[model samples]
Target chain A: MCTYETSHVAVEGAGKGADGWFPVTEATVYFDHPVAAMAEHTLNLDFLNRARGASARVAVELDATSAYALAQAILERLEAAPPALTGELHRR
Target chain B: MRAMDEAMRAETVKFAGHGGDEIEGYLGQPLGGGPYGAVVVIHHMPGYDRESKEHVRRLAAAGFLALCPNLHVREAPGASPDDAAAAARAAGGVPDDRLVGDVAGAIAHLTALPSASGKVGTIGYCSGGRQSFLAACSLPLDAAVDCYGAFVVEAPPPERGLRMTPLLERAGDLSCPLLGLFGADDQFPAPAETARLGAELTRLGKAHELHTYEGAGHAFFSVDRPAYRVEAAVDGWRRVLAFFGEHLG
Candidate 1:
């Protein structure tokens, strides 16, 4: 079934899409039917540059376990960053 | 039955859609046939892709002038189907009123074809399934088929970002005979929900048939997905063809 569940976030980053590197301003996350994945459903993430159009998107579809692991890894790596470079100093 | 040797033509077309905006579509028709019945093939939520176009061709092979409009064309005109689908999803899915208008446009396009028989029906899969029912209720059609459509009797939770409301209330407005095919194990519109819809249609004295295959889950007819169940899909198609034949043949 198409879950139709979605979460959108505004993010500041760069993603490499079909053409090249582009500034990504939004991220949409959902668990639903995949366009090409063999699984019935997957954790889909789309990093998009809305201003650049729909083609300017970097998409990933991962199994639940893999998606959870990747999420943990991202948080771990960010926490391990040096305080000066982690943006914490800038917040101060 | 249609002769296997008959030629068919499939092509991309542009027509005025919702709000009088021009949208793209894929059209398929059997060649050398006189006035064939028409069907508007609505694509699943994944956008109008290769598989959806293939379905249109198959319908043409079955002797109908079939057309599938690009529901996401307004969101991303030149983008790939997947990208366009993603874009549409982020934009909170298609509005119900707009979907009806677009389908009405598709019906007009088909009826205007040289090979049209003046009779038109609608068949849709997944999200398209719900839209098929919506269009049938909102417009006059000869027949309507809803294949594993969700959220007809129940709406998604407010947080899901799918803004559609429960369409069961519109059952009274259905203008055509309706056929619904569902999977017993599908959760979106679970067996209970399907039963509820069936009961409501019956209470309203609408002409309809609702079937749920025991061994099939959602998207049992999706050939490329793991959810595809041959037996269920086969029987479902048989019923679909027969229903359309009775109403539009």
Candidate 2:
């Protein structure tokens, strides 16, 4: 249905794109028609470094179930980490 | 049948877009000697990718000069189409004023073509469909086609990040015949919304025709996507070509 909804976030991390690894400064998330995915609409996420240009991006398109599973897994893994190993200072 | 035998040329072009900014575009035209009508192909929300370019070439094969402006070029110069689309979306989509200006420049470029017949039209799909209606309301197009363009008669929810308003109020300014193609099962511009638009245009005495294909949903014309409905797409194309032929000739 061409859902124009989008969510943007500023992040501090590195992602592997076409040109090896680059620090991603932001992320854009949306559920919309995919560029490569065969589905009519999918959960799309783009890790981008705007300073490096639009080409500096890592993208993924996943179905709703897969996206939800991935999100839960991320939260579970993060929460399972010990406080000493994943301290507040180390987060940055 | 002639389209099957037509010799055509398709290539990348550069032109002045909104605010005279140099932007990239795709140009496609038949190699026939005589003059031909022109069409401005507005890329859908997914951006100026393969399918959009294919639309331009198809029009050229149908014996019309066609051009599609890269609406995301400014946001991500030289970026891949998908990345550029992401950038544009993050920027809250293109401004309406900018879209009108870019289409104006495209018309200027088209009419200047030596083989142009001085008549021009526009056809847009998805978001471009709404933009096509917007452009027709603002520009002097000979004809306009809106294929499942939502937000024309109703506003999107506030969280959608689409910085656009409903364009129904501008119907009085529509300078050409309009052909609306819709899917009955679509929720965005539900059948009721299209009906309202039809009613408004009728009251205003504007020349128009609208058809909603039952059992078809949004993006039915998108062959690469699961929403594709061959029956609807084929019929829609036939109507589009006929409309363009009548008005642009």
| Fnat per model, in the order shown | 0.81, 0.73
User: First chain TM-score in every candidate?
Assistant: 0.91, 0.90
- Candidate 1 displacement at residue B114 in angstroms: 1.5
TM-score of chain A of 1: 0.91
On residues B1-249, what C-alpha lDDT tens digit does candidate 1 reach at each position? 352666799999999999999999999988865568889999999989998998899888888889999999999989999999999998888999889999999999999998888999999999999999999999999999999899988988787556788899999999999999999989977999999999999999999999999998889988988889999999998998888778888
C-alpha TM-score for every candidate: 0.97, 0.96
Tens digits of lDDT, candidate 2, A1-92:
67568888999999999999999999998988888888877999999998898899999999888999999999788788886977984575
True lDDT of residue B156, candidate 1: 84
The DockQ-based CAPRI class assigned to model 2 is: medium
Clash pairs detected, candidate 2: none
Candidate 1 chain A minimal-lDDT segment of 10 residues: A83-92
Query: Per-residue lDDT for B1-249 in model 2, tens only?
Result: 124577899999999998999998999978876478999999988899998999998889888889999999999998889899998887788889999999999999989998899999999999998999999999998999999999999998876657779999999999999999999999877999999999999999999999999989888888888889999999999998889888875
- Candidate 1 interface RMSD to the true structure: 1.4
DockQ of each: 0.76, 0.67
